[model samples]
Target: MRNKKQRIAAMCAVLAKNPNKLYSLNYFQEMFSAAKSSISEDAAVIKQAFEDVGIGRIETVAGAHGGIRYIPSMPQAARVLLLKELTEKMTDTSRILPGGYMYIADLFCTPYYVDGMAQIMAEWFVGARADFIVTVETKGIPLAMSVARILNLPLAIARRESKLTDGSVFSINYLSGSSRRLQTMSLSKRMIREGTRALVIDDFIAGGGTVKAICDMLGEFMIEVVGIAAAIVNRYPQKKRISGYRAIFELEELSETKIEISAC
Candidate 1:
């Protein structure tokens, strides 16, 4: 016998834990021992409160099979603030590595930064309705995994070395724009389901060769790449092989003990 306020609080907690999961009105009604109309009212109140605080939104489905689901979407202003914080972190001079490469491994290692990246990317690709997330091995795994967790989608990784132990794997070779050399990338055959739409993600894109190679591999499995995302994109001399990808930060300039970056 939960009261009105108690029921509403419970509903918000449940929805927050299970974002994108559909829950029938009857399900909540039985759990709370409340009427359908009462449950709906509780949801409405929670929905408005969530929207007002920039937490997310509650969606109601009308059909017999439909019910309600919570979407963990962030507002534009919050997203912009997050990117601004990241830009300041990227401008640190100590993070610059040899060969003019900026090291951002520290940022990716933190849950706060990675989770914020996931939220921003989820907001960006919400309309795309991507089925799953794809990324190359090593640095991109954190961002890819975070996005997959937030979006409730599976993640597939593309490895640079083909694993014979994992059975038959698909491999492809592409020209690395930075090194100006050919590089081979591979992935497990069973990772991605055929005919599914994929969103590709990467940590940094200098010339987009790695992501381009991942897309080329996806073609073999008939997976439609809906969109691509990166945490950072470097401003380099050569043009990127792949286009239409979004990033959180752009490397505007790099010099000895100097680094410049801005939000993308």
Candidate 2:
């Protein structure tokens, strides 16, 4: 049997996973079959626990759209510490490519590091009050999923072509990476509700062209862009930052060899 404190902690964690939804006390009560007063008191305990941890916050909103929201409140000290750690890992030449770009794929998929990156990005987004996560197909999905899990929200993928997403809607073409070939991408317009709050992300950024196209479509839905992030970035490709967005890695061409990296 779960103790009251344990139950409370679990409840808070659930709400923390997804702070945007309206979770009624009735819902909790029914799940636990506890009284309303007991559930409310448990919530209080959970609230205090979050405060002590100092990563994020929980707030209760009332009526229709009313529910608790977990706001990640990272102090400057924490951000500095995290950045220091991330930079240290980034500095290792072993992770660097001969082409000048740091090959941090191993680091990105690492349990601990990806969790750290997710927290750093989550804290940043929660602070900015972002609501949705957006990304293109393939590599970006996993990272986006991590962020969405922390935020407890849904992710929108701009597909390369019409997938079996059901009820096909629309498609767009944009230059992919450094290639001259125009590639088609898609999204079920119905899948996206109006006024979505998007925080765009990618696995690699060589130019702002793809990001811009994604943003342009988001504009049609009147969504607000929270920010942007990338696992790696090739800075010299376009020599232009997509004004108002921030990238995580600044890539350089170090060495290009056809060395077969060991498969995971």
Candidate 3:
């Protein structure tokens, strides 16, 4: 018999990892070996916790695939609160590096903070009423998945290099921050229907090439792009100010080795 908080945490964990998955109460029944009624109680507690915290959503689907799924949702307060926290952490000077880049990746991966970051970005997508979440290959998948879960939409990744995917969209391009030659790519034309209002997300943004390409690709489908979110924005020689919404702007480079941070 798990205690109140423990039970709620456990159930919430399941839903967080498996958002958009139709979970069965029966699955919870077997996993915890508690009475169905008791599991029901735990679920209700966890569901409301999810909503009250503005982390995401809790939905019931009725039957199979019909348990508790954490769907993405928007509540303004949650986003504001999280951005504040991000700003605070970035205040530490040690987080900065040379060449006007900031080091907040460690904090981003921290189990202590990643969840909060994930929730806020998800809310941004929801607030924009975006149809789905989009990001370039690598580094941004975590944030994308979090928001995708919140929105109950799909998480589509653009590959840096072509994979086994038969129909892929490929663009030869120079990365924004790093002039190093790179490939900006995605799945075939068959994938990614036209006219999706995608919310672009990333771990950080120094140069805007990837974002620009993502916007351009979305254009192919006649999809409207709502906006973009990053865990941190390192304002280097090139300032990145996207339209419609100002970024949370979590971090900045004071010098090659020094950094500064601000919250939303």
Candidate 4:
């Protein structure tokens, strides 16, 4: 038989893996062969520990549909520290491409970094309770998918070109604010339901043209954009097409000889 401390650790692990899910006390009582009161006490211990660490929180809902659920969180200090580390890594001059853009493919390809970034973004909009995560296809898919997994929500991708694979699609054309050219973005009609809340996520934001275009397209479907998050935000143009977005890193300076980055 597992001891009280062992049981509590196991329960915390289960709750962490399935965040935002409710589990009845009776279910855990049976699972651990303990009384309801004993299980509740164990939960209290775990909750205090979670609060102390600042890594996350455990919410106990009351009443019939109530149970304990784990909510991921990060301290402000920890968030700033992680962003600073990422900024240092991005200072490599070799990452500067032909254009002013810095090569960030390595950051996206690394699962450890992606997971950390996704946690930060998820924490930023946890209160929104978004129904869906929206992003442009390809590059933004990984980051969007990560947030979707954390929130246990569906992901909707806006494609560069409409395809037969997505039957009965909706398309929109808008000018790329940065490139000063027109572009088309598409999404399947069936993928997004009407009047649902969505969180917009992407790997990078430059002039906010793509994100603004996506928000406009979602408007046609009566979807609400609760928030926008990006891994990197370029500092050029000074003003962006979209407002109220969060980013982990902001590009401060970029040149042939050196690159500068800062936490955003």
Candidate 5:
């Protein structure tokens, strides 16, 4: 039989791996071969530890169907630190492309940065009770997928091309904020249900045209956009096409030989 400490550690590992998933006390009691009282005590310890370390949150739901679930959250201090580190790394002038765009494909592909950024973004919309996480195709999918996993929500990707395999698709044309060109994005009719709440996430936002177009498409399905977020927001244009969105980093300045970034 596992000792009390061993049981607690094992339970903590399970909860951490499955964020926002409910686990009944009885389930733990049977798994650990312990009494309900002992299981509760073990959970309490794990909860306290998580709180003290500021890693995340352990919520205890009461009632017959109630149990425990871990909510992935990063403390403000940790969030700021992570954004700061990312800002420093991204400020390297070499990352700036000829089109005045900063290269961040590597960061989105890296699990360390993706997970950190997703956790911070997910925390922002936890209270919004979003039904689905939505993002544009290509770059935003990775970060949006991570956020969906953390929040235990489904992810829907809007594609640049509407494939016939997708069946009936809803398409929209919006001006690209940065490129100043009209672009089309589409989503399958079956991808999301009406009257649902969606949280929009993107890897980068410039004039915010892409995200705004995404929101407009969701609106066609009667899906409400609860929140919008991005890993980086360009400081230029002074005004974005969309409002009330949050970002981890702000691109303060960018040039072929110079780049400046700051944590938002």
Candidate 6:
């Protein structure tokens, strides 16, 4: 039989690996071959450890169907540190492209960066009462998927164009916030149900055109946008087509020879 220390360590592994998932006390009791009282104590210990370390949140749901769930969260200090590091890296002049755009594809593709970004973004919307996550196609999918996993919510993608594989889709035309050119975005009709709440996640927002288009499309399905989040937002244009969105970093300037970014 495993000792108390062994049982607790095993439980921590399970909980940390499956954040936002619930595990009943009875389930733990059987798994650890311990009594309900002992499992309860073990859970309490784990919760305190997580809180003290500021790694995440361990919540105990009350009720017959209740269980324990680990919610991924970052301490304020850690959030600041991560954002600061990212800002420094992004501001490197070499990252600025000819079109006055900063290249961040590598950052989004890296698991370490994406995971940290997702944790921070997930913490912001943990209480948003969102039924699922939404994002436009291409660059935003990776970050969106990570956030959805952390939130334990489904993800719905809006594509730039409809594909036959998508079957019947709901399409709409909206002006690109930055380019001022009309663009069409579509989603599969069966991707989401009506009257549900959605949280939009995107890799970058400029003029908020893409985000606004997504919001307008979701509106067609009667899905309420609970919140919006992005990895970066351009500081130029001063105003965006959409409002109430949060971003991790703000791009203050982007030129061929220099780049300036700051944490938001």
Off by over 4 Å in 5: 75-77
Model 4 misplacement above 4 A: 75-77
- lDDT agreement with native, every candidate: 0.86, 0.69, 0.66, 0.87, 0.90, 0.89
Q: Per-residue alpha-carbon lDDT of model 1 for 134-212, expressed as tens digits? A: 9888887988998888777889888888787757788898898889898888787888778889999898999988888
Model 1 CA deviation exceeding 4 Å by range: none
Candidate order by decreasing lDDT:
5, 6, 4, 1, 2, 3
What would the TM-scores of all predictions be? 0.93, 0.74, 0.65, 0.93, 0.95, 0.96
User: Candidate 6, which segments miss by more than 4 Å at Cα?
Assistant: none
Candidate 4 lDDT, tens digit per residue, 193-256?
A: 9999999999988899999999998988899999999998888877999999999888878888
Model 3 quality (TM-score)? 0.65
Clash count in backbone of candidate 2: 10
- Give RMSD to native, each candidate: 1.8, 5.2, 5.2, 1.8, 1.4, 1.2
- Please list all clashing residue pairs in model 5, or write none if there are none: none
| Candidate 3 lDDT, 19-105, residue by residue in tens | 666678888777777777887888788777777876566777676546666675546775676666667667666776666555666
Error of 6 at 143 (Å): 0.7
Which of the numbered candidates is closest to the native, going by highest TM-score?
6
Positional deviation of 199 in candidate 2, in angstroms?
2.4
Tell me how candidate 6 scores on lDDT.
Answer: 0.89
Q: Could you tell me which 10 consecutive residues in candidate 1 have the lowest summed lDDT?
A: 231-240
